[model samples]
Target: MQTIVIAGGGVAGLELATRLGRDLGRRNKARIVLVDSAPTHFWKPLLHSVAAGTIDPSHYHVDLARQAIDNHFEFLCGEVVDIDRAGRTLKIRARLPHALGHESVLRYDRLVLSFGSVTNFFGVPGAETHCLSLDGVEQAEAFRRRFLRLCAATSGGAPRVNIVIVGAGPTGVELAADLRHTVDTLVRYRLNSLESPCQVRITIIERGPRLLPTLAPALSEAAARKLRELGIEIRTNTAVSAVTAEHVTTADGEVFPAAIAVWAAGVQGPAINTRLGIALNRNKQVLVDEQLRAVDDPFIHAMGDCSAMQVSDSTAMVPPSAQAARQQAIFLHRLLAGIERAAIPVFRYRDQGTLVSLGEYGAVGMLRQVIGDRYLNVQGAMAKAAYRVGYERYVMANLGPVRMFAQMLVRWARSRWLMPVKWH
Candidate 1:
């Protein structure tokens, strides 16, 4: 039996691993091994909520070992250090608690790379060291703790608490809103003895001309308007020159005193990707062909935020998004299962649209029209409902529907009856 080793237990890698495990491993055709530095998997999209204290990660993360046992695959908790292309082998270093585990090398018949992205500080001085980021579960939890601490410190003396979020992309925007909601909830629950609920000031700074610049202008305007209505500040076309523990200085010499500074600027492929010796794009993402195979090597394939593929004959590449990653996983499943062998269909990303949740403030979405290139903008109750179930629906469709629903029910019950905020 052939062995398939997938590095990175991210959204794409995990989904593809499970699918291939069921189809090939169960039949004794292939041995599927999923390797990741982290022992558990948490959806990247929900990191913002986690940082804002609006959601708890314990209820959402999937244990890789448990999943591997249930799905008929092997899970290895380690970091891929080196790959010998000619030898078809990889060296992995186990990531233990504070102590480093010995490295182990494993041979594979084929390889798939999907080690997702990391926070790109863009070489900003002091940004990398001082600013908090929502890069992973640990980082998000750290931010949540800092947030609660800041609230506790400022609740009595300070008239206001200022939080500066650099970048107006989806993460920054959604995080600002979620943080605002969390603060209000804290105040309402008497967790913070603030003079007023609006004492916490949140500001998002974006180098781009507007928030959600990749989306339609109308949607951007709607998001901006909604954020302003919620007392959140939006500074567009502003570039940050430096970040410090006390303040964030912009290119224009303006300084914002911040109790908490978050760098939600952008993302790039993990730096270890260079070890693969494959052609990579400017963002350090592996450049792959239409079949999702590395352009320089056929035996290695990449997907998710770690891989970049050109769209058709255009200069544009597929966007790094959860939707795109999920689509590519599904396409790979079909391609690998021999369902499209006669004429291996090229992987094409269907733009289902983008949804931004604002917690209780409301939500905004841009739904792509199935017929044309235009998108329909939606907001209010309909958009909020869609945003709420968007992730649930995706998980249900991909994972077992009944199991996902039961987990969601438990989460809802816990939030409603016990506690909604994740202080611990």
Candidate 2:
């Protein structure tokens, strides 16, 4: 049987593993193995909620080992250290200590790299040491703990809790909004006081001229307005020069004293990807052909944030978004299922629109191709509902009906009991 090994259990890797397990593994046509550093899986987009303490991570996370057994695949818990393209083997470091010391070489007929990206600090001094990043589960939990400690220490006083969020992209904006909701909930529970209006201040600093610069101008303006309504201050066309323990300095000679700072400004390809000696773009993303195969190695394929795929002649490369990753996974799955490489279809990215949620009250975005040449410009509750539905559909499509329904029930149960009525 053809042995297929997938590295990373993020969105694309997990979806591909499930598909292959059900189709190939069950039929004994191939052996599918999924390797990841983490023992469980959580949607990356929900990291904001996890950070803000709005959602419990336990309810959302799925054990990789359990999932593999149910889905008919083998799950290996390890961190991939190196790749030998010539031998089609992966050098993985087992998680155990001295008892399970050293590495294990896993050979594969086909290898899929979906290792994902890491937070890009851009070599700014003190930035990595002081700034909190919401890239993974641990980082999010750290932010949550820090926030709670700050709130507890300032109890019975109107404290000026300053939160500085770097980067005005979707993730940064969403986290800022969620934090506002979290603070509001805290005040409602009498954990903090909002009697002094705007006491809990949030500043979103973006290097670009406008927020959500990746989207259309109108959408950016709408998002900015929604954020302002939620009491989030936006600082555009501003660059953070450095970060200290208590303040973030800007290029314009301004220092913002922050009780907590979060860095969501940029991302870079995994470090291991660079060691593979493959062609990479400026962002360090692996350069892949139309079929998502590395130019130098057809046996190796990459998807998600690690792979840079060209979408248009003018556009240099596709943005590393969850949508793009999901689309790539589907394309790769089809290519692997077919025997004739020549007959395999090329990857085509469909512009399905973008959504930026602004707290619970609303969202702002352009629904592309929803009504022909003119996009549907949306804001407020309807827009927020639409955005949530889109995410739910994506999750359901990947996890299938049964798992999706079960997850929904689990969420409902958690909301009813486990979740705190109010969080600071």
Candidate 3:
């Protein structure tokens, strides 16, 4: 039987591992091994919510060992250090307690690389050390701690809190809204006071001319209006030239003092991708063929944010998104299931839609394709409900129905229990 090893254990890698483990491992045709740095998995998209205390990580994370047993796959907790393509082997840095580490080399009959991307700081001065990011659980927790400390220190002193978010992308907007909601709740509980006489100051800085630059201009405008209505300051056509401990210096030389600075400007492929000798695009995303195989190596496959695949003649490459990563996983799974290499179909991306959540009661986006057109624009409460349903559907699809229902129940219970407890 052939042995298949998948690196990352993120959304794409875990899904692939579960499907392949059941289909191939159950039949005794192959062995599937899923490796990741962490022992548990958390959806990357919800890191912002976690940071803002809008969601708890305990209810959202899945233990890799338990998931592996349920899905019929072997789970390994270690970070991949190097890949020897010629030798069909990879080195993993074993994580042992109280020691630097010993290396373990694992050979694979087939390999799938889906080690996902990381936060890209763009080398802005002080951006790395000064600004807070919601890249993973650790960063989110750190941000949450800092947020609590700031609130405690400023209680009854400032009329409002000043939070500056650098980026007008989905993460930034969602985080800003979530943070606003959190502050609102905190104020109602008398946990913190706003610095201003009237309202809390939440600023979103964007280098582009409008918010949600990837979306339609009309949608972006609507989102901006909605955010403003919620007391958020949308600063478009602004670039953060540098970040300091106390303030952010813009390209126009405007300095804004903020209690907290969030960097969600952009992201790029992980450092390991650059060292793999694979062909990467300008953004450092590994370039993959239509079949999702690395351009330079047929035996190795790359997916998720770490990969760039061309979907159409006009479009240069597919955008790094969870939807794209999920589709790529499905396509690769089909190919691995005995479909002839040459006969395997090329990847075609399906743009379902995008939804940017605004606080608890609001969201903006489009949905339902207009026949030949791929884009859809939706707004108001209808859009918000649709977004929630879409997220539930995604959770149900990735995690089985039982686990999904349990998660919902747990969330409801947590909300009831934690709402009255003041962290400060």
Candidate 4:
């Protein structure tokens, strides 16, 4: 039997493991094992919300071990340290210190790497070492802790809770809106008129000409307008040369004072990809061909944010988004059933438009017509409704429709009877 090992149980990886497990492992046709550094999985898009304390991540986390049992696969918790391509082996380290102190060397007949990406600091001074990032749950929780402390510090007086976000992409924009929502929620619950109006000021700095650079121009304009109406500041065409403890200095010599600095400017594949003896782009993404196999080795496949699969007919590379990752997972599930390197099919990513949530205030997104090339530009109620539906669809994909409905009911009950996790 071919032993198929998938690393990094992110969105694409988890879904792939489940599908492959049900198809192959259940039938006793193959051995399927999933490896991840984390014991649980939370959708990456919600990291900003988690950081803002609008939602608790633990409530949404899908336990990998539970998933493995239900899906008929095996789960190993580890950080894959090295790939011995000649030996067809993986060197992994225990992801948690509490686990047994041992290094594992596992061999795989087929290997898939979906390890995802990390925050890219662009080598800007202090960006990597100093700024907080929303790349993972721990980091998001850390930011939330600091934010709550800032609110606590302003118990009886006005405090300027200044935040400098060094990117104006979806993560940055979403974070700004959610942070504002968090402060507003705190004001309503903990801070009364006897106190100040949260004293929170957020500034988004982007080197690009506009926010959401890859999005439709009209949609970007709409999002920017909405943000401004909510009293959030935007600085376009502004580049950060360096970050300091108290301020982020612009390339043009201006400085923005910040109580907390966040780095959401860009992303690149994890550093381990560079040492894998495969061809990696400057961004550290494994350069894959049409079939999603590493250019150097057919046994090695890379997916999601870690794989730079070039567009079949265009110069543009596949953008790192949950939509793309989901599409890839579905495509690969059908293609990898044979578990062979021959007669592989190329992956063609579908464009499903974009959705950028503006916290509770509202949302903005452009939905594409499945029948045509046009887009349905959406905002306000329509966009907000669509946003919720998008998440529901994801839940349905991961947990099935019946479980999704039950989960939705639980969330409604919690919101009705219990205060938000921030209060706890």
lDDT tens digits by residue: candidate 2, 1-424: 9998999999889888887888788888899999998888888988888898888787778788987987788999889998888898999888755425468999999999998888899988889999999878999998998887776556346568789999999989999888888877777766654443366789999999999987789889878887898889999999999999999999999999999999999998978888998888877878898889888888889999888888856575777888888888887777886732666468888767788877665788877775675677778887888887877776676577788888888777877775352254
Instruction: Compute the lDDT of residue 21 as modeled in candidate 3.
Output: 80
Clash count, one per candidate: 0, 0, 12, 0
The TM-score, computed over Cα atoms with residue i paired to residue i, of candidate 3 is 0.93
Candidate 3 residue-wise lDDT at 25: 78
Per-residue C-alpha lDDT of model 4 across residues 200-219, encoded as one tens digit per residue: 88999999999998778998
Worst 10 residues of 3 by lDDT: 191-200
Candidate 1, residues 246-345, lDDT tens digits: the string is: 8999999999998889998888999889878889988899999888999999889899999999888677788888989989988887877666765657
lDDT value for model 3: 0.82
- Which scores greater on lDDT, model 2 or model 4? 4
- lDDT per residue for candidate 3 within 1-424, as digits (tens), equals 8889999988889888888887887788899999888888888877888888888787788888898888788988888999998999989986545433777899998889888887788888988888998868999988888887777666444545578999999999999888878877777776654443234578999998999977889999988887888778888999898998888889999998877899999888888888888899877888988888899999888889888888777565677777778888888887887643665478888777778887584889867586876666788878888877876766786678988998889878877878732254
